[model samples]
Target: MYATFPDLLRLLFVPALAWAAYHDLRVRRVPNELWYPFAALGLALLAWEYVLVERTSLFLVRAAVSLLVIPLAYLFWFVGGFGGADFKAFCVVALLYPTYPSYYLADLALPLVRTQLGVFSVTVVTNAMLASLGYPLALGLRNALAGVVSKLMFVGRPVAVRQLAAAHGSLLETPEGFSRGGLDLDALRMYLRWRGVTLGRLLAQPERYRDPATVPAETNDPGDGSVTTEPIPDPASEPAPREDADEYDDPWGAARFLDDIDSTAYGTTPRKLREGLDVITSQERVWITPGVPFIVPLFVGLLLALTAGDLLFALMRLIGLV
Candidate 1:
């Protein structure tokens, strides 16, 4: 048996985990190209151990345990529990480390630490899941210190109608206490599709957005509550009408974009700036979902699994509960 080769195995497993973590952190996805090769290599290595090294029993048992876990991972992804990349990463882990490698966690003295786990990848995932559970506490502490605890705690908070047009990760409220889907980026993207604007464009060049006065008006249907597809002339493009005053300043000004945010899903009305001016001007905040990317905690779990074995098992031993 190649006892020294475990160090080489660490080199194999850790690098792929690190690389996937990097891309997942950056773009919220890890490409299939990364995991696919690693998965194939893992299977090949397992095959070599079984056929060439003559460790048939160990190889079969390890592979069997890992294979059983795959369906559960797929089910999680199917139910929207996690992303595709996370599920694939688990599969790759199963292939790479079906059992605990001889080189890893050699110094740990915990009685519960197994030399070889039923499925080593399951331990890694369990550790990762436990690590992710701590994230909310971390976020709560961060928001508390930042003095946004009240805003963060509430599911929704009142914000100015003006801020609604530019808000991210937050929702807007109609005066009658219904929510507009401000945080729902998908719906907003659909709404912006007709304007030839993508989310990237909105983020990059918000100033280039069409003037609110120029947006084509839609006729409201009282029956089905659908807006009719009626094209209207852009008022800004029309010739100036004769007036007694030399200049008339629009009180609403740039905030006219707020009117377009009304959604049929919630049956929300376009809230006026004046209605919530008191709360908006004073609090100057809105409700936010405060979502964290799953990859960060997954990376942390990988590190802990390498050095600390199973986190819940370790904790049980520490408190003498086992």
Candidate 2:
């Protein structure tokens, strides 16, 4: 009649993951502090579960699952497929629900399906990956409706250069042709703010700054040298350029800016800035793919794993392969 401890812990994941998904969507970053309490609780649950089972076969299964899931999480992060936050999340999931938890609502059993592996965290991740497959299909449909036909349409959309500063994605098209490593827009916005000039102004007078050699450097930087959380201003609101503005022969010192800001944080380098600037100055519209954060699908996957069970496993079973 009453919910078990594990079931109660499973329910707690709803709010925790929901908040994490919301945070990741709002800003690509998730605070490390958010995982601490959940991780601690998971460890406590793990210890309790361990003591309860001791040297039983169930304990061995849990231990084996833990060993597998933790390294898999680390591997995902090491290979850059998963973010640090995602890695930590998976670790917590492994500790909290190494095996699928059983729950029921009256006569109905929660998670209508179960897999032979019974690794709950793996189910959540696999489900997340399956859910993410929908994004490309949606992008392809939208692009097709707009009369844009290209293989690239499945992964990216065209955005105007004027909107680039305010955009969320990386550029797929560049002066060097198509590049898998898209230009980082956050770094571009940071560069703009550092110069006290809007993207419109820069684009309109590209000759004045395109070379980077002639762009003027500030005598004293205005900001506290931290990346600002403020929204990038719309290019439409950009002030008109002064007619009497003097051209500088000195270099823009973009590398200096990158160095000062610890460029690794933004995933940008001087070469990338130069290439991105070339594309921006030369093109009116560029293709970009606004990457969907994995956490969004991970949240969906967690919900599905708790309800309908492993989507991949279900599909395999349906196809008579599992």
Candidate 3:
């Protein structure tokens, strides 16, 4: 049996999304350039479909779907729920498949389930969200089996301070308390490298560096207090205000390093760094959440959206809602 134009177009997403998922998993980044060709192809296909379609009403529905998805994707990104790459991917998907593609395997129709809405991208987003729930569930189960019974078990796992640098995640435990916005480990490593000290070295004698005034000088300094040879910005003349300064004197000794680096570049802030350092230096084990990128689930969601239709819609139907 010959495949339809829409079917061929839909198949294109399989490899494209697979590559994106792999890239996101490996580096947690997806270059904007990767989507350029796909975007162009999608626009061309949409134009071609517009010129060839006999049903004006159906064409309008497709156009509406594409229009609706753009802002929705942007909103997700704006609220920090989705990354910029994830937003671009959804936009490309909207352009490519505004409605569910009509595909078949021999005598069987693909997407065994269907929804009245028929917006393919929305289905993909929903399916991806549902699939992402598995991460927490798996974490919870693993923690349970390991005899750990804490609410945090569902979100994070404990890692030794020495291994924290190599781990891929954000710090959940902090000196102050628990934080929803976990500290960025990459930022911590960046700061450590800037200081010419290893995590182990810092933890071995945290008290030695507890007072920023007495902390050892940076290795990169020329000992003449010159900024010419400095790798990063010079540390601030005065450290950031410490809430507990009167109670405890720079417990982590990390306050002096905050102003020296660009926090935005590392996706962290001074407060997070200060608190995270206190936890890292003072404790042997810390909790960290494996920050899974959304693209992975987006890929799985796309596959399920194409093969099984909207899982949520099917669930609603099973419960006789539609």
Highest TM-score, which number?
A: 2
For model 3, what is the C-alpha lDDT against the true structure? 0.73
RMSD of each: 10.3, 4.6, 6.2
Distance from true position, residue 122, model 3, in Å? 0.9
TM-score of each: 0.60, 0.84, 0.81
CA shift of 56, model 1, Å: 4.1
- Going through the candidates in the order shown, the clash numbers are 0, 1, 0
Top of the candidates by lDDT: 2
Decide which is better by lDDT, 2 or 3: 2
User: Candidate 2: deviation at residue 184, Å?
Assistant: 1.5
Question: Could you tell which candidate, 1 or 2, scores higher by lDDT?
Answer: 2
Tens digit per residue, CA lDDT, model 2, 50-79: 777455677668557765777987997877
* 140-186: candidate 1 lDDT, tens digit per residue: 66666767655344343334334443343334433344353333322
> Which residue pairs in candidate 1 collide?
none
Instruction: Assess candidate 3 and give its TM-score to the true structure.
Output: 0.81
* lDDT tens digits, residue span 1-322, model 3: 4467766866876898899889777666777898888788778877777777634787768568766888988997887776778889888888877767777778878788878877777888899999999989999999999998887999998888898756766899777677767777766666655555566766886654454554445432312111122344443332433334444444444555555544452456667777787788878788898777888888999899888999999999999999
- TM-score for candidate 1, residues paired by index: 0.60
Worst 10 residues of 2 by lDDT: 218-227
lDDT-based ranking: 2, 3, 1
